[model samples]
Target: MDSDSHPAAAPADDKTWEELVKNVLRAEMMRRGVSYAALAERLAAFGITDNELNLRNKVSRGRFTAVFLMQVLKALEVEWVHVPASIDDAARKGGAQALAASKRQP
Candidate 1:
């Protein structure tokens, strides 16, 4: 049984999680038809002051902090987040790679 014969599954890296969160948040925003301007207003209601450009940059970069995520979710009135049964499925369906591919299209 050579170790090289069967490679083990690689752990989920930070980028994967970041992209997943980014996709989820953006999707939710899209679903609710909430623009960055609108979202900024909603967040302000929670005492989370952030401009539209900053929010867009933060979300597009997918590097926001957990506290920021909580604030956004709360502002969006998100009761629950849907999790895929497997991370692989999520990556395929709503991961950074998928997001990038979609952006490249016309």
Candidate 2:
């Protein structure tokens, strides 16, 4: 009876959510002109040890956790978050495919 179990429910794959979060993080980094090394340095000051390689791989693959996302945003001094009002149909299609694939497995 869960809403997500319904036939018409949209895809909510981890990959999709990760990509969504990664996109937001990248945009914020760009806006602040914060390079990987610089961001790492900022985080280090707060006792985090993220380096350029970790940042590159993590963000590029969009496989990081929500806590990491919040840390990055905090290091960037981002006081607000925003979700785009529109998304491309192509992205939605991809998410749906991923969701279907996930459901087919055990």
Highest lDDT, which number?
1
Q: Rate the local accuracy (lDDT) of all candidates.
A: 0.74, 0.67
lDDT of 1 by residue, 1-106 (tens): 7766854454469876666678778867865778899999999998889999999999987898899999998999878776533445445445634433342211
Pairs clashing within candidate 1: none
- How far off is residue 55 in model 1, in Å? 0.3
Find the 10 residues in a row with the least total lDDT in model 2.
97-106
Candidate that scores best on TM-score: 1
In terms of lDDT, the poorest run of 10 residues in model 1 is 97-106
Estimate candidate 2's alpha-carbon lDDT, on a 0 to 1 scale: 0.67
> Which residue pairs come into collision in candidate 2?
none
**Measured by TM-score, how close is model 2 to the native structure?**
0.68
